[model samples]
Target: MSLETVLILISIGIAAGILSGLFGVGGGIIIVPSLLGVYAFTHFNSPYIVHIAIATSLFTIIFTSLSSAHKHFGHGNVEWKAALYIGLSSAVTVFLFSKIAILLPGEILKQTFSVVLIIVALKMLFDKKGKHEDPAEKKPEVFKPWLCLVIGALSGAIAAFSGLGGGVFVIPLMHYLMKVPFKKAVGTSSAAILITAAAGVISYFINSPAGANSIPYSFGMVDTLSAVPIIAASIPFARVGVYINRKTHHYLLTKLFAVFIIIVSLKLIFF
Candidate 1:
């Protein structure tokens, strides 16, 4: 890769990492598209490269989220019961869907994943417009096994296709569905992302074409070589994002972020 490509990847990593930490997201939305942006700029034409990028980003999240989760769990904020419920239910779905994801052409998967990001982000933004996590909201009912499994399954499917941890969905579910406190929901979601992302990545590796190149860290695959710097730099920035999240008026920022995601998704789908 050229110097320009390297720099672009580094930028994507740091930026995505910060976003991941601040919002407790998986960073796939940013990483996958940023890989496309890298490909567009570098003139690479490998079909599965974007897939690799998404996979690699998910792999990276395994570490990033673990670290973040551990730290947040330090505050006794993580909710083990809820996270386990979400992870268990979704495990089967993530496995099945990741296999399906491997079968589709990489380009289509890339575009579809982008669209998923757009839709989820829009939901998040709109949700934020109202009370995001009102303590006054109703409490979760008796934890039904089926309901938990269904939600977990949905999260897995989303992660399998889009490389997100499903934390975006998970947090809201905790808030609106389970009546979890906002901070606890965020902590639980971060932990949940680790489990769900790990399961999805394993499925991706298993279902992809044989050989090193099919998964992350291979030549054109997940491009871990390119994604590493981003992961490293994100450590500092993620903390910053978390701090900023507590202080800033997130309404405008969330809307702006959502608009950007929509524009980028449109470009990838059409351009």
Candidate 2:
């Protein structure tokens, strides 16, 4: 690889890690568009370019989410029950839909990804701030199973299709509809992304071809050469993101996430 490519990948990793930790997202939002941007700049020609980008992004999320999750766990922000509930449901859909994703046209996937990003960005921008719960009011001890199933299916399907982690959907559901506290929602989303992304990775690998169709230094759809350096670069920064998140105000974090999402959406649409 060229020096320019190396620098780009490393920069993407650093940014992705910080975003993942701060927002409880899997960083796929940043990673996918960045990978696509690189390929576009290099004029890389491959029928599987989008597939490779998505697969590699999901693979990177495995490490990024784990690093973020560990920090969230330490702060006791993770809602273990909610994570487990959503994760189990989301994993099944991710595995099933990723197979379909592997066969879809690249243009179709890209368009779909753009649309999803737009929706997510708009939601973040307009979502109501969390209302303070009365101290005497009792919150439910458990999440509804039906709601979990619906969120998981939608999140997993969209996430698997775009190679973005399910945390994008999960965080919103937790924070907005479920009324989960911001920090706990982020922590739980990060934890659940581990499972959702893992399932998508497995499905992509299984459906990917070997031999001529596979890229050099790749395992199945995943580009190992790029993923390794990115993972390494991102891990340390994830801790930094978590620390910053703890110190940052919730309103600031929410606005930051919205802006970041909008920027990513525009890139995917116009790049």
Candidate 3:
């Protein structure tokens, strides 16, 4: 890869890591689109470019999520039981959906990703600010197993298809449906992303098409060469994002990000 490409990958990684930590997402929102842009800029055309980008994003998310989750756990934000239940359930669907994902055409995959981005952006744009509740007044976390299973299944499908690591859905579902606090939801979602992304990466690796090895710097569907620098940069920045998440409110920033996502989605859909 050229130095320019490597620099772009690093920058994408930094942004993705911070977003992953801040929002409990797997960072695919940034990673996948940015990778597609990188490929386009370099005139690297491939029928599996979308798959490569998604798979690589998932691979990087494994490390990013781990870093973010560990920090959140230290901050007492992670709900381990909830994360376990959701993550384990999601893994099943993630594996199953990945098998299907690999069969789809690159254009279809890109379009699907665009639609998912719009949905996530809308969720972010309309989401109400979470209020701080008194300890005594806060409801105990009481997520039902069945509901968690349902949420996990849905999230996993989204993760596998969109390479989002499921946190976009997981965070909102846990916060609204299970009544989890926003911070706790974000932390738990990060933990769950670790499982979902791992499942996705495994499936993408095993199910990769013939000649996948011919792709430069790739292992199966994953672009390992790209993933390495991204993961390395993301790990430390994930901790930085965690710190920011804890120290400040960013309602305006979230809204702006949502707008950015919408614009990106529009470009993907129309341009």
Candidate 4:
């Protein structure tokens, strides 16, 4: 890789790690686009560049989510039972759909990813239930196993298709449908992502296209060497993000991020 590309990946990692910790995502939101950007500038010629980007993002998420989840667990933010239920259920779909993802055209995949991001961004922007409410005033909702399973299944499909770690959907589902607190939802999503992304990366690794081994510093479709720098930077910063998540109200940050997602979606669609 060029020095310029390495520097950009490091920058992407820092941003991704913080966002993962703050929002319980797997950092794929930043990683995917940034990887695409890097490939564009570096003239990395390959028909499977999109697949490589997605696979690499999933691979990196394993560590990012691990770091973020550990910190959230330390803060008593994780709902372990819910996370396990959702994650285990999601793993099935993640594996199945990821295999399917490799068969689809790259343009189709990009379009699907963009649409999902727009929908998720809109939902985040308009949801006002927790904006001003005191956490102490709310009663925790009962955990429903069936609902979690459904949510997990849906999230896993999204993760496989978009490489977004399923957290974009998982967080909203748990928080809105299950009435989980925002912080707990984020924590739970991070834990769930660990499972979902693991399933995804495995599928991508084993299902890589023909001649994929010729790609430098890659294992199957995943660019492990590219992922190394991102993972290394993301781990420590994920803790920093978790600390920020705990220390302040995130209402404004959430709105800003929602806008950011919309912008990213548009870029994917038109660029």
Candidate 5:
């Protein structure tokens, strides 16, 4: 890697970190697309190296989520019980699906990745942000443990394959199904991403092919050089973002974020 490339990666890291903190996402929203552009431009194909980028993004999220989760947890907003149940279920699914992902052709995987990101961005755009706070009207409990598990499992599988932290659906699921306040659900979901991201990283290690050339300095699929800066930058900026999030409505933030995702996605698709 040239010094110019390292500098570019650093700039990407700072931007990703700021966004991750603001949205409670893994910053793969930024990382994966940026990586795809760079890789395609540079023509670095060490067999399934895109998998390495996804894996590396997950590792960075481990720390980013930890810091953000702790902040939300301290606010008494994180639903540990729900997060744990979902994490366990999703981790298993991620492990299974990741094996399949490794076996697919590389170009197909990129297109699949692009499609998934498009779906996520569109979902964010259309997601109804109902009044976050619930009234005293007696609403029946809607989510059972098994249902939560199912949701988590799907989240895990998708996150592993697409380099997402699964915040897109998790927030809506908890709010609509369990009557969790939007803020609380968002906090808890951020915490859950920590586990889901870790699970994805582990699965990649188990599934990564031997003698794959894209992994220059990696154990399993994580590219440490790419991940280290993301973690370092995301942790502090995310803390600031969390603090800002406390004051601003996350719904508005989500809407703005969706627009950015769409713009970036279009740029990548066309470029």
Candidate 6:
């Protein structure tokens, strides 16, 4: 790859990592779409362009999510119990669905990904931000293990299919359905993405065709040149994002998350 391409990949990585930390996402939201654009604009023109994008995005998330999660962990925001249950449950689903995803048509996968993004954005946009309860006054309901498992499974399958970090749904699912505080949900989701993305990367590697990497220095569907630079660039930026998340209010985070989902959705649909 050219030095110019490496620089571009690094730039993309920096943005993705920051967003990953900021939103507790796996960085796939930025990585997948950006990679797709890069491939398209550079005229890579392979039938596996979408697959490559998703696979490479997932691979990058392995590093990005871990870095972001570590920051959240340091802040004591992650719910370890929830993360454990969700991550393990989702791993199975991600593995199974990823195999199926490889068999599906690329256009169908992209369209489905777009639809899911739209749904998530709408949910975030209209979601009621109820008044925060005083923690000292009354304790919230117990976090159900079964519910966490089910949600993990669902999120994992969808993430595997769409090359997402599963944060789009995972964060909202925890906040709305599970009654987790937005900050906690974000932290927990980041931890879960660490597990889910790893499973996705492994599955994609196994299921992908032997020569799927049309680009140089690729492993299966993952483009190593892009993955390395992006991963490196995203790490420190992810810390910055985590710092911002700690200082920012939840409402702002929600709005920003919603807007990002909408923008990415439109790009996927029209681009």
Among all candidates shown, the one with the greatest lDDT: 4
Candidate 5 structure quality by residue, lDDT tens digits, 90-109: 78877787777777633454
Backbone clashes in model 6, listed as residue pairs: none
Tens-digit lDDT track for model 3 on 1-271?
8899999999998998998888888898789889999989988888888888988999999999999999999999898888988998899998998888878643565468678768978987887653344221267776799988887887788778778887766875776578787678889999999999998999898899897656676888998888888998999999998998887654554565567667656765664
- TM-scores, one per candidate: 0.77, 0.86, 0.86, 0.89, 0.81, 0.89
User: C-alpha displacement of 110 in model 6, angstroms?
Assistant: 6.5
- Taking every candidate in turn, the Cα RMSD to the unseen true structure, in Å, is 4.2, 3.1, 3.3, 2.5, 3.8, 2.7
**What 10-residue stretch in candidate 5 is worst by lDDT?**
129-138
lDDT of 2 by residue, 74-177 (tens): 99989887888788888899898888877775456556766776787687677665434311124543477787777777768867777777776687677666
What is the C-alpha local distance difference test score of candidate 2? 0.79
Candidate 6 C-alpha lDDT tens digits along 1-271: 6787788889999998889899988877678878887876677877778788888998998898889999999998799999989998888889988888887854565567678878877877776653354121244745899999988997797777778888877787787677787777888998999899889888888888866877888888888877999999998898888999998877777878888878766765676
Alpha-carbon lDDT, every model? 0.67, 0.79, 0.82, 0.83, 0.71, 0.82
Worst 10 residues of 6 by lDDT: 130-139
| Candidate order, TM-score descending | 4, 6, 3, 2, 5, 1
Clashes of each: 5, 0, 0, 0, 0, 0
lDDT of 6: 0.82
* Residue 223, candidate 2: C-alpha displacement in angstroms: 0.4
- When 2 and 4 are scored with lDDT, the better candidate is 4
Model 5 Cα displacement at 106 (Å)? 9.6
